[model samples]
Target: MVTGVEAPLAVTRVGVVGLGLIGGSVARTLVAAGVDVVATDPDGATRAQAWDAGVRTVGSAAEVLVERPDVLVLAPPLAALPAVLAELAAELPRLVADGGPLPVLTDVGSVKAPVRAAARVAGLEDRYVGAHPMAGTEESGFAASRDDLLPGCTWAVTVAPTTAAGDLLRVLALIAGPLRGVARVVEDATHDAAVALVSHVPHVLATELLNLTTAAPARALALGLAAGSFRDGTRVARTDPRRTQAMVAGNADAVVGALRDATRHLDALADALEGGDDAAVTAFFDAADPVRAALAEAAAGDASPRTETVALGEPGWRERLVSLGAAGAVVARTGRDAITLAVPPPSPK
Candidate 1:
């Protein structure tokens, strides 16, 4: 319903290449918007869940390629991004490039620099934009997918100078409609560094904290007693190891730098505790309290909800995704109707 220049184009067909938490959420949101969604995943059961959720599923990227969707969202792990681009390049050169050729392509990869580099190398840079939706739960996988996950999160949209304005607008529309968050335009490097600071580095710190608890004699008891604060502090540490590791590994330098800064902050906190400086401790809390308050306020204000509609071209892909059993059926509706898709529950894994 949010009108834009591309409103005339009307996103009829959207192809999602993954059925993980992020990908499944995207499809569900699009379906709620009345857009026909075709999706594929390597996991068979995942595809079935997606179908139940109402999205059409396809067997492979090749099948999606043949469908020639209006937009292709590459929602894969950071490490798999390059290979996915390669696969797309080999499988659907002409179709993707049709209409003078080239469909608008975007990705939901957390890391940007490497993805951009890989796309550039693969010669898909022109149509591709690097995007990161800064919202996630401690859970993952298709079962965890939820349309509302994106609505109030920051979604970074990175583009090179060569990216077309129309294409950029279309990408923004897709992200903004579902996320209801700011479509921040940042350079790839800046996006990577920022995510490293706010996301990747925190996950590392949380993991370390959790590890300390694991070695304690009363670990089981401690875990049992763990309540809201402990859960909040260590939530990210509970995300899928493979996904978190890949993100950290991909953005190594920035994460390391952030960790160094965090260490310095921790050292100062330790000094205050050792010195028994009540004033310093109070000051620390004073400073942190306001920051946290402001962040919460900002997040609340920025994560407003909106409805998005997406149109579909064919039924094959939707049927295939439904069969994966990753999530549930997505139906067309207006005004926040698509926000209820199943979200993966948080697991120790």
Candidate 2:
């Protein structure tokens, strides 16, 4: 049964499938929060590290399934998702015969829709939920993972029509209850489209900018002069190219649309620069001022977020939750009768 928002996470154990940066950080974070974590990764060195962090390390996904964790987090690379799902499907029969409840399966994939489709094909859709944490370094591997990554980050918890209300609340327990992070509920399609503009296109732009800088005629001069903008834009470009490529491919349609829009804007800016249109250039920055100021205000925490109770269990409550997330509010506390959300801080006028 769902408890008050402030109650400790009742989940006895969480099983993580891949102990890479995202998964490793989750395992460590849960372990630190006093949750028992059992995980499996192919790399022995990575498994050893997770074991040292107090997580019980297993040899494979099937072993973890046998252990019957309350939540099973699938964190393999996108390309590995199909095979991983297949293995889980094969392991299900053995688990079900024990006459115990199955784990609530979730994933930390960047794109949500494709992962949902794969899970649907494997017949795991009923119990599956999509989650994408809006935090992570460009770095990969278990060694680079930090338990502290969970706090203050927003986790986009995507759900479909078939998702159980109880299952949804269970994931929220992990995100808000123990991890001390924001839980934003969105539909799978909404998540893919929004993340494309906010995440994938930026990754592409960062990589292209780094390439442009590398091939410059005065490459050494430019490298020596590079500062905050250059460094910040290209930070995600330092990620392992292969993984980034797969993430982009997983959401190719949305990324393509976002890229075309970006290109159109860039072309207009280039035209303005070439013509030396001072007025046009000034207009561009002038229009962007509010967003810049709003972001600054957010960073400084100048405006405190407001809170109120939003009722649940109505016929259309799930859709209401989606509206809350799209409106920038995060679920602050979930209860049996209602959910309390913290409305986003005000934007600068």
Best by lDDT: 2
Candidate 1 residue-wise lDDT, 107-199, digit = tens: 888888888888888788988877888777467899989887776666677766666556665666566554354455566777788788778
lDDT for model 1 comes to 0.70
Over the stretch 196-289, how does candidate 2's per-residue lDDT look in tens digits?
Answer: 9888888889999989998999999998999999999999997788867887888999999998987887787888999998887777668778
Clashes of each: 44, 0
Runs in model 1 deviating more than 4 A are 1-9, 96-101, 178-182, 217-228, 275-293, 296-349
Largest TM-score belongs to which candidate?
2
* Model 2, C-alpha of 256: deviation from truth (Å): 1.4
Q: For all the candidates, what are their Cα RMSDs to the real structure?
A: 11.1, 3.1
Shift in Å, residue 248, candidate 1: 1.9
Which parts of model 2 are misplaced by more than 4 Å?
1-9, 302-304, 345-349
- Residue 127 error, candidate 2, Å: 0.6
Candidate 2 global Cα RMSD? 3.1
